[model samples]
Target chain A: MQMDERKRKILRAIVQDYIATAEPVGSRTIARKFDLGVSPATIRNEMADLEELGFIEQPYTSAGRIPSDAGYRYFVDCLMGAQTLSDEDKEIIERESTKKICEIQEVVSQTSRLLSELTSLTSLVLGPQKGKSAFGKMHFLPYQPGQVIMVIVKENGVVENHIVDVGDNLTAEDLQKVADVFNQKMKGYSLSQVKRSMLHEIYSELSRQRHLIDNALEMLDAILDGSEEDEPIYLGGTLNMLNQPEFRDLDKVKSLFKVFEENEPLKKLLLPRQEGLNVTIGGENTLKEFRDCSVISATYKVNGKTIGAVGVLGPTRMDYGKVIAIVDFMTKSLTEVLARGKPRGYK
Target chain B: MQMDERKRKILRAIVQDYIATAEPVGSRTIARKFDLGVSPATIRNEMADLEELGFIEQPYTSAGRIPSDAGYRYFVDCLMGAQTLSDEDKEIIERESTKKICEIQEVVSQTSRLLSELTSLTSLVLGPQKGKSAFGKMHFLPYQPGQVIMVIVKENGVVENHIVDVGDNLTAEDLQKVADVFNQKMKGYSLSQVKRSMLHEIYSELSRQRHLIDNALEMLDAILDGSEEDEPIYLGGTLNMLNQPEFRDLDKVKSLFKVFEENEPLKKLLLPRQEGLNVTIGGENTLKEFRDCSVISATYKVNGKTIGAVGVLGPTRMDYGKVIAIVDFMTKSLTEVLARGKPRGYK
Candidate 1:
């Protein structure tokens, strides 16, 4: 299983050639095209060893070999060279990152579209985790006669609103008083940091307004204590999968489409587990639907906190060296753009 | 050519048979399947007349004939029978309509998914029009040292927020005073109804706070006067296109995918024009990409005001009776569910 220099060189050649041409690589083709400084016979012996070790597989007895999942894993891990992004791609990233974005959703969506277009693969950009954002402000605005729109603004500038029925008895002033008390207690704490004890303490302190604002308080408590909602998945270039030769079979296309429709499984696959870039090749994926695909994802940070991730999905023979570079570069660009926070033309 | 009862019956049989089975309908097959009293030779003569009239076309020289776009239109307009919803589909629609939907977005998205699952064709649901909703209330909440979140809530319960920078010099009290002025002036006026003269009057009245709130006012003016922003398209079952026999060719799939990816053309095709259900078949579509397809769309209303639409897209040989019935029924169900507006468990 140890990959010496010669074996590594040959394996890299096969994977790269297959990725570029979507054609299996024979020892003769490799020796002719890759300039390995070795004869076709010697390369043939090495190819047989690679196949024996499970790095490559032949689709037909007579056909040449293509990379197995393990082969791609090894190629991505040990042999892939540093990839410099094309100037055209770099320009697109710069232009999108520098655009006057009014909302974080726009940034995430633009990034997803840019990733898909550049790499010609399906892209998924997970929106920032609202649960991780520190409380900035809260407002209770009177809506129809019996309803109120409760707005929550997070430190990272994400906003969420829910309607609560308070009946016609309570005036706008009454709701304002409750908002003041809630804001005083919850400000600067992330949703996860606002524990049950803290909520109980706040309830006891607001005993006088308790009955009138009970429903609002309960709703607030539920939101703070609830399991994290799924981050909105900004899917882009879903049809790009059609361009890949691996998805020519309609069943594969259907399975992939079903995964996109369900969304939870794909989100689970892309959820950032740790800092930095990661690649899951073929069988490395736990979901059966994605077992035949490769995913390259990188967590993006804002003020040193891992807030979201952008990922690319394609066949296992994906252009790893290029897609990985684009994804890695995108995360950095997004981080810088978000951290700047001062959109051009904003007074 | 006038369509006599016999011609109509024969054309209906041909269209229905072709729809049920993807194969072209030979005169002999039609004679065997249908209880037509006429002989095969008589049916063949009538089919030839239908072809001469451009209602049907033979795919190959000797193969049976299939309905042309004109034939489908004729079937839909004159020959198709009223279709009743299957009990299973009715149950699904009723269940979705009655479910606890906290937001209009949830209802629209759920309906799109339901449409796709029921018919096994791609579905598109256009969300409610924000421009049509009357103004309800507006709030300006203080955020970071130099920023404010401006929230506009329409009468229909849609909420939109934008961040405006007002600098640290303006206090929360200043924002409240500005909001009071805006609420008093803009309440009950739809965005379309707020005239330029009315804005001029407000600007003159807020002359004292003009410099401090100039950017916020300009943003409001821009939003009020700008063309409508694209309503979010809730697309579902895009991969369902592969299930159609006509889309087996990769080039056709790619063209359909490209249309979905671009969105503007598709949205234009689906935008509700009139009050009732409408169907565009095959060559009738203005877009070349959709010329080989059919789209059935119906606008759903709330309180008798048309606001949104739901549509089904499939090949030219789509089950017109079934899809038209579903789309028409869905619009009615959506209209009723939306008008109720009172979600259960809202306390």
Candidate 2:
């Protein structure tokens, strides 16, 4: 793992050339192309030493050498140059993110599409963590007989509707009264803030109007129970996988497709982390299907609190340095976008 | 391509064995495992003839023979027997599809997941074509000074929301009256059904109510213009490609991932077709990236009209018979579910 300047230059050259051509690099090719001012024989000697150090591999006798996974790891850690996003890329991100921030769902969904298109990698953006969000406003509306519509509007302007079956028909005026009372009582209070004691007090006060209060409580339970539907994980750009040669094998391709389809494993993979970007390399992944791949993920925050994760997946040989940088940049960009309120022209 | 019964049996044996073991099949092993009642010498003679027929190949002189692409193709076409889904798989599909039919997005998303899980192959479900749908109901709700929330409800009960910025301000009552009038006039009419003459007549009649009439016209224009946000092609289960051995090569993996992320090409790939299922094999797909993959896609229907496509993606070596059956069954299942007004409560 320890290397001097000459070895570092040779390894960097090998990785860069291999990444570009996707072919093994020869000492001659590196000497000719890089103009390192070294003879092929000397370069060969150093490459042999580097191979012994496990940074490179000779795929076949005459085909020259390619960077091994260890070499990629080293380059990503110390040798690979920082990749600055082009002005065009920055403009794209700004233009795309600057659009109306209607809801957290819209933000995450659009972010997923924009990042995937920008990075040309399969991108995943986890929905806002509901547990992290404080309750905002809850409204109840009557729809049809025995059906009540409960709407929860988050501070972030996400409005989710749930239909609860109350099993008893109620007059429209009575339902309107219930909506008013429920809104007055629950406004600006987090679900957790409504403690059992508080609920007991409210229950006793409304006991005289038992039927209306019971239906209101039932509606409250339905809204709280349906919170899971509010948090939807967004994935975009899966067809991009068809263009990669790594997925050419039928079995490996099928297994990966299955993994993406069966999102439970991936949901676990993108769970919110405490700090720093999480990089799970091939063998390090718990899922057997993803063992040959690497996931570069970072949790994006809203108001300095971690709310969701953004991730990109590719071969383990993915340009970790670049992907990490891209993911980091996207998360930052998304945070800034979400912080800024909806654009002036938008509703 | 023509062969005797003995030759067909030998080729089928080789393909089946290779599929299971992912290893070359030797004459002795095939003869022993298959109980062909022929000696190794006789089996070897048949193997030599099979090799000459381009049905199999020898990786090395001493190694066993592996089925060539043509051999696998033949097995898929004429030799492979029907494979049944397990009872668990059937129950899973039935349960999941039933639960998912409540929402259009969930139906497409879950169908992809179920197909990928059952076949262990990547699946793609194109979003239902909004253009093909007749308008069921449209509602316009005033949001702020100059913006309105246009909610379009389709015949299938799919709801799409778009925020349109109009240059005029209207009161809440005016917005509600506009919504009611528009709904009364446009119900059961497709976007194409409203002609310019019809708009002119309505405009003339509502000349006194300029703001409401103008906003309604703008809403109609926005809907007909097909804003990008109004319709998005759904792609699911792409992570499955990472598990394919063909993508083991880093560059190949990157390129494939790139294709999936850039879905414009995929949208073109799922172009509108007439009714029935369409299977595009390797070399048949126009996209260069998909030359090695096969797509089994079928258009779904509502009210006897094609609305969207659902498909599975896998290597050209995929089990065609099984995929075809699954796609066919799922398409029928989806149509039936959508046809039912609401899912029946499970006991």
Candidate 3:
């Protein structure tokens, strides 16, 4: 049998109704609520065909139907319609996102909160990659007689500082000269670019300052690639997920919570497939915790490179059209703010 | 009407059993589970007096009894005995807490995760007050032609850097001179001390560099008291709270979650009453969201000052002995780490 237009309309109505009421959608309810322009008997015949084709499922003996994972996938792929966000929502998202946020961590945390508030679902926001920050300025200050602190300021205004001990051979003036040499060579380059290409030149020029350079190079790598500054997922309004009726089962909530605590698994689930919005329906996700959830994510960017992602986790009965629209708008707004914050000292 | 040792033992047994099972305690179960050496008829009579004293209550018309807020308070105050953690639990907590974490925020986040994991309850770890960090070192680095970035390294390895614009008269030499003067006077003091006592002396000496000094002081104040670095309540294992049987009601769970999101309310709830463990039973909480829950918090200190707090939030039938022990142990471990991490620049 062909998957025709009429069957598509019926499936959309079922998914929409289940999302609204958290109840099974019956053929009669569809006939009454949605203007599919068909009788309940005809709708029932179409529902049977849809279920047979695996686009929908009858959960139990007497209950109405729910969209299966394949059903949601089909709808997302071929049938999802135009999504419009309200003027009020657009204003709120824009306002929260455009605040003068200097640090990427703050931006991620704020974005996560706004997404959760706007959509009433748990939101996860990871910061731009550590390598995304270009080297702006590095400062060398005498911490004590034996130790010096190196502070690296990124053009985007993130400051990461670490301590290193210097031998008696290096004076405070020598520290400044060493800093200037590194600064001149590595200026305007992000850590990723520097690590990939610039290390050979840096290592050769500072050969005479071998003792200090050894420690300095180590500090530089740490500043660039270290996990100390690795921005973990900023989870916001996480409890909002409990509002869903399907999570009433304690065991179900426990399994999902475990995945959240073990953030790496959920991070894998949200990692971008291509670029833009990626939706994984129930059973489409490999993690057992997410088997009951549908994840909708969008990778956010800075200067054309995809650096991080934002995601919303909810029951499969989520309002895909509305949530997708919110996510799409949020990522764009985030990108605009990031563009405005061009790294300082890049020249 | 005389309250004797037997009555205290019965109340303790009832509270302990209710906490363990999340079920109403009955006279027969008490006889079977705890060795009170009393008949069911005698236990029933004692239970009536306990209820009359507002320590235990019956829901609807059930014969089984659950402890009321008053009962919990009575147990915590008098009947509760000291509880010890197992050797395995002690080792796990010590290992996790004693990791070589230098940043206060990372320390707080790790501690929160450990507390939540050890107790199987939601944990809240507040960061130390901003004024708690003493000055370690300050570096002045040239940035764009008109601006210079000032990086302040705290003893705890936290680096805060901000860009400041310099005037035309302030040559590179003058910048170094101003830095040396400020560094000489402010080397051993905290930001609070610098702001409180040394501002006048420094302002008079660097009067020619007043334009930069004005902005630098303003920046210093902002760094010391800014909300950007405000120690937010680091909440961990929040989903674990859903595992409680009491959270089976979606509405209750939703209301409680609202408090978690609106962190100010929850912060108020956890703020220390004194310097040690604070046990606020269900009705004892001022916040309405916590009326059905209990909180156990202990203030963690650095040096001798009480800097921040750590707490656990759970339903009133919480395992008080275990949770209290965990909170107490976690706070002490945190204090030791803070002590070891004395700010770097302090003489």
Candidate 4:
């Protein structure tokens, strides 16, 4: 467990070489490619020691050794150099994030695509969480003879529409009057706050005056009663997995895709637990499907509150330093975009 | 090419056998599997004649013959029988379509997933088109001190929001006044109708008294000016393509995925040219990228007007009769769901 200086250098060399070539690293290749002053015999001895310490393993009897999960973790935590992104990648992030995207969903969707394009890895973006967004306003429009469409807007610019049957009796003017009352009372309250405390007060007042409007009020309560189900998980660049040498086996590709399609397990994988950048390398992830993969995720904030996360999924042999740098830059860019009132067109 | 009853049977047997097993069909295997009265020698002579007529081809010099694109076309048009859905497949369609979906996008998205799941191929669903939809209503909510979020709803239940800067001088009531007037005039008119004839009448009238509201009108014009960009082509089960033997080559998989990732070509391929079920087999597709694939697509309706399409994409060896039947059933289900107005909650 004690990683001496020579062992750390050997582990870093193996990991970097494996990531670049996708082939196991041998002592001769390391001595030729990298200028480590040590001879091939010394490097070979150091590799054996690292393998004995459980940092690397030989995939085949005659083949060179490759870094294990623990090795990747150590390189990321200790031996990796600071990542400096290429000018092209920096420009891509700037061009994509500043495009004329109007909706929060568009912002998140584009960010997801940008992450994958930049890193050549599958990206998943959890859109801004709805629980903390306060109620901005509400409007009811007469849709059909017996139906009215209720459009609710959140302070963070999330919009949802629910159809309610209010019968043929209520005209557009009448529904507008009811919507005005609800808007006045519930204006700056978060959805949870309105669902808990404001529902009783508003319902009692409306029921005492106009009993007929009680149906619409009850429908509003029922709409927000359950948690927001429409919060989407945007997935991009799944085909990129096919390009990875690690996922050349079809079974691995299928298992990874099943997690994406099922969504529940992927949501668990992406749920941000803390404030800053987090990396879970192979074997560190709780889900067995992801044991061969590495995830680099960071939560984005709105008004300094963590609202959602953006992350990348790739083979454990991924370029950890570069992917981490891209994900970190993306998280900061997304937070800035969402904090601005309008997603774009301010120029 | 004419007056060939025996040749028809031989070609039908070859197509069916090859579709079942992705391998080329040999005369011995055909004679053993099918109840053809002809000897293997006789079948081989008939296969040679069918190949001479451009129906089938041998992949390698030593391999048996496989159905060419022309053979598949002939089988679909002449030899294929009426498809009957299995009890399990019918139940899956019934269960999935009747789930508690609340949005048209959800309906199309679920249908795409069901198509791919049932057929073991990739599915694409184009959400309801916005051109033929009439304007249902519009609302303006104060987003920040100088901004407003414009939520526009179509009669077909599609909703869109655009944030516009209307200056801090206008109150919520003033914006409402402008919205009410516009909504009153534009209600029940198709988006094209409003864009063409009504723009002059409304914009001239609004600019006469309050030129401040003109910015909002211009935003609406710019929003609907270009064709709908958000009609959203939902693609599902791309990983299923990898399961096919034809896509085992990573280069082929990469090329196919590039077509799916880029929207314009796929959009062109899915555009419904006529009513009822449409099938384009290999070599029939105009795009070279899909030359090795077959597409079965059908347009869905709302209130008797064609609005959108659903389709499946698979290798050239796809089961034609069954996929056609399933796509037909889904088209009817989607049309019915959209015609009912509410996507779900009616039960």
- Model 3 superposed RMSD (Cα): 4.5
lDDT of 4 by residue, B1-347 (tens): 56298889889888988889999999999889988898999999898899989999999886889999999999999888787787788888988767766666678778998999999999998887655556667877666677777777766566666667776677777777778778889887755566645777666665543554566656655555344764569998888998999887777767887888888877877886778788888988888878989999999876687778899999889999899989999899878776664563111
DockQ of each: 0.61, 0.16, 0.52, 0.43
| Per-model B-chain TM-score | 0.90, 0.78, 0.87, 0.88
Q: Taking the tens digit of each residue's C-alpha lDDT, what string does model 1 give over A1-347?
A: 66689999999999999999999998999999999899999999998899999999999996999999999998998899787888888998998888877666668778988999999999988877655556767798766777888887756566666778776777788788778877898888865677888778777776665664677655655554352565568889988898888888888777778788766887887875667898989988889888879999999887787877889999898999899989999999988987796332111
Model 3 clash pairs are B136-B345, B155-B343, B155-B344
Could you give candidate 2's per-residue lDDT for residues B1-347 as a string of tens digits? 45888888988888777766667789888888897788889889888998999878898897999877667667766787774656676677778766634446666777777888777877877766555445656656444568756666555344545555655645666666656666776777665678787667666655656765665555555554454334555665566665665545656555666677666767766653556877676666788788767788888776686666788888765667677778888888887776673421110
Q: Model 4 residue B183 lDDT?
A: 88
Off by over 4 Å in 4: A95-101, A134-136, A142-144, A155-157, A171-177, A180-230, A341-347, B1-3, B91-102, B134-138, B141-144, B153-159, B171-177, B180-215, B222-230, B340-347
* Model 4 superposed RMSD (Cα): 4.1
Most DockQ-accurate candidate: 1
Scoring only the second chain, what is candidate 3's TM-score? Answer: 0.87
Residue A194 in model 1: shift from native, Å?
7.1
Candidate 1 vs. true structure, TM-score: 0.89
Binned by DockQ into CAPRI classes (incorrect, acceptable, medium, high), candidate 2 is: incorrect
lDDT of 4 by residue, A34-108 (tens): 888999999998888898888899998869999999889889999998977788898889887777656666787
| Among all candidates shown, the one with the greatest lDDT | 1
Global local distance difference test of model 1: 0.81
Q: Largest TM-score belongs to which candidate? A: 1
Candidate 2 residues A1-347, lDDT tens each? 56899999999999888766767899999999997899999999899999999888887887789877677778877897776776787777778877866456678888888877876777888866664344455545544467655555544444445455555755666555655555666666555567787677666655544665665555555444445444556777776665565666756665676677556777866763446577776666788887767778888766787767899877665667667877887888877876685421111
Question: For model 3, how does the per-residue alpha-carbon lDDT over B1-347 read when each residue is reduced to its tens digit?
Answer: 76789899999999999999999999899988999999888999999999998899998576699999999999988888886877787898888866775456678788888888888898988777665555555668876777887877655455677777788667888888778777788765666676644788887888899989887767766765454354478898788877888888767767877778666877787897777899999978988878989999999886687878999989999999889988988889888877886533211
